[model samples]
Target: MTIHTGHPFADPDPDPARRLRGRVVGAVTLWTAGDRADRTGLTVTSLMVALGPEPRVLALLDPDSDLLAGVRETGRAVVQVLTWGDRQLAEAFAGTAPAPGGPFRQAEFVATSYGPRLATTTTYADVSLVGEREVGWSVEVEATLDAIIVGDDADRPLLHRRGRFHTI
Candidate 1:
C-alpha cells in the first residue's frame, strides 16, 4: 500500500471554496440511521444547531451517501459527538480509512429509537427529518431535535480542519 505522509488533497490548484472550508475547524460527529437489520452512518463536520421553540439541526450531507438514504427511508437518525479517542472511528465512517467488516464493527454500538449510537458517546441527539434541499454539491438536511444528551466536557472533542484531525 502507498502511504501518503502529506495532505491527500495537496494540489497546485485546489478549489477555493474547499480550501476555505478546510480552514474552518468543526467538531466531528457520527450520524447514523436505519435499524439493526440495515444501518448506515457517515462522519459529518459541516453542521449547526439552531435553538428556538423547537431546536433543530442543520447538516450538509453528501447527496449520494448511504447515511442520507437511510435517513430518508427511516425519517430519523442519531447524531453523536465523537471524542479525540474516536479518531479511527471517525476516519472509518468518513471513508478515509479502511474498515474491516464495515465501520460499525470497528466499535461498540447501542440501538436507540432513532438508530445505533456509539456506545462510548456521552453526547448525542435524536432527530427527525423536518425538510431538505439541494445546497451546492450537498443536500442540506434540517431535522428537529427530539432528544438531546449533553455530556460533561471531560474528554476533548474530535475536530477536523485543514484535512486533519485535531483535539480541543
Candidate 2:
C-alpha cells in the first residue's frame, strides 16, 4: 500500500513524473487561432503529428489559455513548428516574456480559413478541431488536417529538454 507523505502541496517534489517527463525531448511549436481583433495563441511543445488511418494533430493545451478559447469559438487553429531563432517568440507566447502588442506581436501571421498561419515559418498546418477531452488542468485536443504547408526549414527545428531549448 502506498503511504501518505504529508500534504501533496507542501512537498517539494509534488510530481516526480513531471521531472521524468521533462527529460523527454519535444519539438517547439506555436499554436494559434482567431483574428487580430480577437487573436490568441500560445507556445507548445506537446504537439504530436500522427499519420495513420486519418491524419491528426494531437496536443495538450491549457484550458484557460486564449488559444483554447479561440479554437472553441473559431473551430480552427494553425500549428507552426519553430526554429532556434524563435526562442524569444516562444517565451512571449509562454507568458514568461513581454510582447508589446501581446504574444501575436512576437511574430507575423497570415489569415487562413483554418486560422492565422504564422507568416515567417515554412512549416505549419491549418487544422480543424475534430475531438477533445479534458485531461487534468489542460485539454487534450485532436484535430483533423485541413491544409498543410511545408518549406525548406523542416530540417532545423527547436527542441526542448531539461528546461532549455536545443537544436540540431
Candidate 3:
C-alpha cells in the first residue's frame, strides 16, 4: 500500500501517469479547420512544437471530432493561441459549455489558406497537413507551418492544468 498525498492533480488510485499529465500545464487554443459553411474547430491543449530551423507543429485531435474530419478532408487548419479572457470560448469549443452565437461569435476571425484564425490572437499559425496517423483515441497530425501571424498581446496566454483554466 502507498501513502496518499493530496495534490490538486494527483491520482487517488494506480493510474499516476494520467494524473501526472494533468499536472503538466499547457497553453489552451482553438484549433480551426475548413472555411465558412464548412468550418469546424475544437479547444486543444495537445499541441506541441517540433523543433528545427522552421518549427513544425503536432497535435492530437479526437478522431471523431468535426474539426478532425474537416482537417482530414481539407488538409488545412489554424492554431490560434487563446488569451485569459477566452475561457468561455474555449469551453464552448470543448463542448462543456455553450456560446450564445455559436463558438465563432465569441471572437472575430479572418480567413487564411489554412482556415479562419482569431482576429485578436497574439500568435496564430496556418498549417498544412503533412502527415497523419491513428494514435490511440486520437488522430495524430503532423503539419508544416505555412504562415504565422503575431499580434499585440503576445505575453498573455490562456493555460490549462488540474482540469481548469489559468493565465500567464
Using Cα atoms with residue i matched to residue i, what is each candidate's TM-score against the true structure?
A: 0.93, 0.88, 0.86
Model 3 stretches with alpha carbons more than 4 Å out: 1-14, 152-155
Candidate 2: global Cα-lDDT? Answer: 0.86
lDDT of 1 by residue, 1-168 (tens): 889898876786878998899999999999999889999999999999999999999999999999999999999999999999999999999999999999999999999889999999999999999999999999999999999999999999999999899996
TM-score of candidate 3 against the unseen true structure: 0.86
What is the Cα-based TM-score of model 1?
Answer: 0.93
> Model 2: number of clashes?
0
Model 3, 1-168: lDDT tens digits are 766567765445756777787899999988999888888889999889888887789988998899988988998899988888888889999999978878887778888778888877778888888898988778899998888777787566899997899886
Residue pairs with colliding backbones in model 1 are none
Per-candidate RMSD, Å = 3.1, 5.9, 4.5
lDDT comparison, 1 vs 2, better candidate: 1
Better of 1 and 3 by lDDT: 1
Which sections of candidate 2 miss by over 4 Å? 1-11
Question: Which candidate comes out best when scored by lDDT?
Answer: 1
Q: Which lDDT value does model 3 have at 118?
A: 80
Total backbone collisions, model 1: 0
